[model samples]
Target: MSGLPAYSLPCQSERATLVSALLLLLSWLATPALAQDLGTNGPTYAIAEPHLLRDLQHRLQAKQASGELDTLMARSRERAIASVRDPQPIEGVAATRTPRTFYYDPTFTLDRNVLDAQGQLLFAAGTRLNPLDVVSLSSHLLFFDGRDSRQRDQARRLIAHYEGRVKPILVAGAYLDLMQAWRRPVYFDQHGRLTRQFGVTQVPALVSQDGARLRIDELETTQ
Candidate 1:
């Protein structure tokens, strides 16, 4: 009863048009279908068909015998591992030459309405919202190129200085290798999404939540 309001009744002319449409539809449904007898159109033959699955299975078997399937599988696995081990570096980001500090306001505009379980609108479309209002950063993000030895050392120093309250995010080089060596989670920007979002353009940068804003410190690493 509380779902939606009832629609208003149609006018006299609308009612008459609706009745005429209904009558025509009923007449069409009640009438039987007609077909003209057109015999001897083409020559008939017995069904002779090959099973699709069987053909596919035979092709697979041939591929397996020739070791082509294994080679393809190996190549696919290698490509997957290579992508994870060494992803494309974040563009327009590099080592910090000069120590600079800036703040980023984490305000974003919603493109679509956010709804709850009951379909009630929580936030309307085009509403500008600051994410810091909802949740604060758990820890400081330390972005450094893993390929550079000095930057890697700088990241280690930062992690120790922050007492493990800093996340090491790699913008370049193998993240899996670092994860294995560090014995903790080493995150990669994965196509520069995080760097782009944070507007980070330099390495040895520390991102920490400063009240309602994010404070980014791009520090130069010591030799």
Candidate 2:
């Protein structure tokens, strides 16, 4: 009653479900003008909605109870190669050993594209790589969340393991804050698309892809 209005409160277990349902109702009840505003203004407008506020509060409680935003990220790595007969061939020596790395930040707003101030574009997702050409990406790195100790450690270890074989790892997890939290787009999105692709339901998952196949590796938390 003190924190929230005394209404028909559901059990804690039902928070996400309830929140989801409330959102649906809110959408159904929303005026065309309000819906248009939502499309233009994005989530900022949605936050002020009565039902959205309540749903957000419930979601906060759920997040706290569930521990940190403990979810696995999509980890994928691949090498670029050239071939005559077998285009995008999966069989190669360096390709089998070396993995292409990415240094990404969903929050990063470049004056231009993902490229640096010097004017170089970042590697596009799903870029093709060859085994012998792995050295080309040696100066590049991958960006991932590093806020949690568990996640940081796992990411660090992965980078170290791949160092020399790759560039110095860039940890972007430390930069996560409330404003950018929602904007924090992981390799996966909500509703479990890429999350399912990588089977990521926990923190510290690694993803690697060969020209022919994809592989995901998760870190084990230490007790």
Report RMSD for candidate 1: 19.4
Among all windows of 10 consecutive residues in model 2, the one with the lowest summed lDDT is 72-81
TM-score of 2: 0.26
Question: What does candidate 1's lDDT look like per residue over 1-223, in tens digits?
Answer: 8899899999999687545444443443468989888886789888888796665556556666887655655665698889888998889998888789999998999999999999999999999999899998998999999999999888888889989999999999999999999998899988888889888898879999999999999988877
Clashing pairs in 1: none
Identify the candidate with maximal TM-score: 1
Residue-wise lDDT of candidate 2 within 108-165, one digit each (tens)? 2234334558867775544444442332223223223344455445544655687623
lDDT of the candidates, in the order given: 0.84, 0.38
Top-lDDT structure, candidate number: 1
lDDT (0-100) at residue 158 of candidate 1?
82
Cα deviation at 185, candidate 1, in Å, is 1.6
